[model samples]
Target: MEPTQWTLTETFQFPAEYGKAVSAQEVKVTAGYTEHQTEDAVRLSGIYHVAANVGFDGEGKEATLDSDAILIDDVDVQDQSGYFEYAVPLLVDLPTSADGQLTATVIDASATATDDGSLAVMWTVEAKLANVEAVAQNVEGELTKTALATDETAKESKQEVAQVTEETTTAAVTPDLESSQVETVTGYVDDNEMLAFINDLEDDVTVTSFRLNDVFVE
Candidate 1:
């Protein structure tokens, strides 16, 4: 989007403690400010440093005085219909949103001594405002699906195991079952498959060791 350009002018008087100046010369001005977006406007707040050489009390002696003045301004982009409108596109591409960049540069300044023992200062600033398209990313959809599938599979397996346990416990006892035997079995796991499965889990999960057919697998 093209940048929007504008000019800002401000005038203010110094405090009375500086004394009435017979002559004020060699005026210098500098500014430091910050900008932010607020709803349909860009708000600016900062301070301006004004310095000048002053001759006071009808004497030839001159002294340099420096003063800081606060500056605040806002640029409202609301149209007559009460809707935010702009010539350039916004960073988020939305009206009524403050997402942009604003910069100001000092253009001109002047100082004058007033009859009330104070110095008057005036300055002009040139500002440029612009915004770019916002960047966005979508990363959670696939992970969320995978997590849901894993949870559903685990739940189904648990239900099947519970059903089998209940059926076995309810079966009638037989005399031929006087001698029962226990069996121990071991199984092998593919290292690459195990590593890949572990890697797919959430970062917060910690897998120490698991048992497969009475054998511990790490």
Candidate 2:
């Protein structure tokens, strides 16, 4: 199967306790997620771990901060019949004989710190769904041989016969085909809501710069 690619851009504020970061260095990000299939879409929910060396003030002193952010998105699949079964078998009912696997990889990622202390993350991912099946077939073959040889001086009426047999078998097969699709999705966290939430926090901290680490899907 060909891979399905998608892009997501999200903006959200971190808990204010980290202190307003004047600069960020050695930033790293990792993501873990689970997917569910709805009637017409696939919902992905997970957490992204962001860690970096953050500078709070003009001073050069830096502190390490590790944080987890919530991630949620929906991928439309209404046009793909039976895709849910192949992509998210755990969320759907399928026979025991059904075999499929879903895997995803983050192809690109970048992050920026907003002036208001919010962090905006953007990434692209490619997902692939593969299915395997077993097939049995009845094969028949016929072999005929005709050989004539004459050695007048080397042999006195001597003949040798040899019999050999060969068989081929296949246990499982995956069809040779591919399907490709791309989708773009954008998500935003309201500035007012984030501001209100940040105001409630005891500390007045914010992110300044971000560096991505790794992104993956299950």
Candidate 3:
């Protein structure tokens, strides 16, 4: 038989709205997973993935700024204060039995100016998540059944003979487990700080929406 593969993805938003602004200079992301054992010798595992769209606001001395790698201003040199979008991928592993959990952490964040000093960027990270590569196996085995019968017969002149009969059968079995679950999570640098910064920016920086992808092959 051929082995098949599948993937599940989910998206999340932080600071849900722009009006509730905060101030920050940098953003960081972290990933984690879980594991377990099945009735069979085979091990069960869960894989996790994380990503984010960072929002930034820049100002002061007309400088350049980079938000999670997105370039805010380069050609136009001036006191820059605006938001930019940036994203990155994170991964981890764990042993999962019937079902496993997946989550995301903001870790940390901040804002700053780029080379040539073109902007006072306001930065924030909105985390994205996905649970991937979860696996399960059939371990316990199959069940068998058997039956026996006995009979007596008389032959020629009161002679008796004994006879026996037997029957056997087997059936496959299914694993004792429930369906796996997929979820979405968010991590923020500092809501108060981000709000404080956004309140001051000339314009609010927008973060791209999160997305989820699920793939399966049989």
Candidate 4:
């Protein structure tokens, strides 16, 4: 009687492995609106990509998984469809694999001199990733500025008005809160003058920059 034969194989990709694990079983992209139009509209051509930035983590860490994967950029996409309904995986050749950040930058590949042709896309960038999921480290976060230093006098005036109203109203009787986790946000109130500053502060906020950048995914 003859013996049997067996073989074991595994495919290790650059910087990482593409397994049945949490990898992109399939990516489904939805088309969103454009941002701005270029003068030629040729520059108006919309394009985007998904990329990963691999770097070595501090010692004690095995390696960085950033470059092992790359972003799916417009240039790499197949022109199989007329519209932008494409997605590519971040496959990079990483030397290590412990920590890294992957960014899916929707590029505006316009040959314009100025940043005049920025597109305001109403696009929804989603992914069908495996256990190897991706998350952005940097988002255009918003800034909340409720009171303007220049409005110091104005706020004082308004707070005075609010205090008067509050004092006159019997409805000012707030329920007595009694809890172990009572968090009374005490602030320096110069004779109760800051109350009027609470106007439409929602509309007074703005996002000036990307607060956090070092995002990682596996």
The most accurate candidate by lDDT is: 1
Model 2, range 1-218, lDDT digits (tens) per residue? 45677666555333344333343333444555676665554555565454433333323232333344332122112212101000111122112232245555567766565565444566676666543332112111111111122343224333221111111112124332332111111113355667678678676465344555443545
TM-score of each: 0.34, 0.32, 0.21, 0.17
Which parts of model 2 have CA positions greater than 4 angstroms off? 12-19, 35-45, 58-99, 130-218
RMSD of each: 26.5, 51.2, 47.0, 37.7
Looking at model 2, report the run of 10 residues with the lowest lDDT sum.
Answer: 81-90
The Cα local distance difference test for each model comes to: 0.49, 0.41, 0.31, 0.28
Ranking by TM-score: 1, 2, 3, 4
Model 3 error, position 134 (Å): 23
Task: For candidate 4, give the lDDT.
Answer: 0.28
For residues 1-218, write the lDDT of model 1, one tens digit per residue.
Answer: 23333333333332233333545555666656666566666666666555555444533233343354221111121121111111211122113233356565567867665554444555666655442332112236667788999999999999999999888877744433433321111113456668889999997887876566777568
Model 2 lDDT, full chain set: 0.41
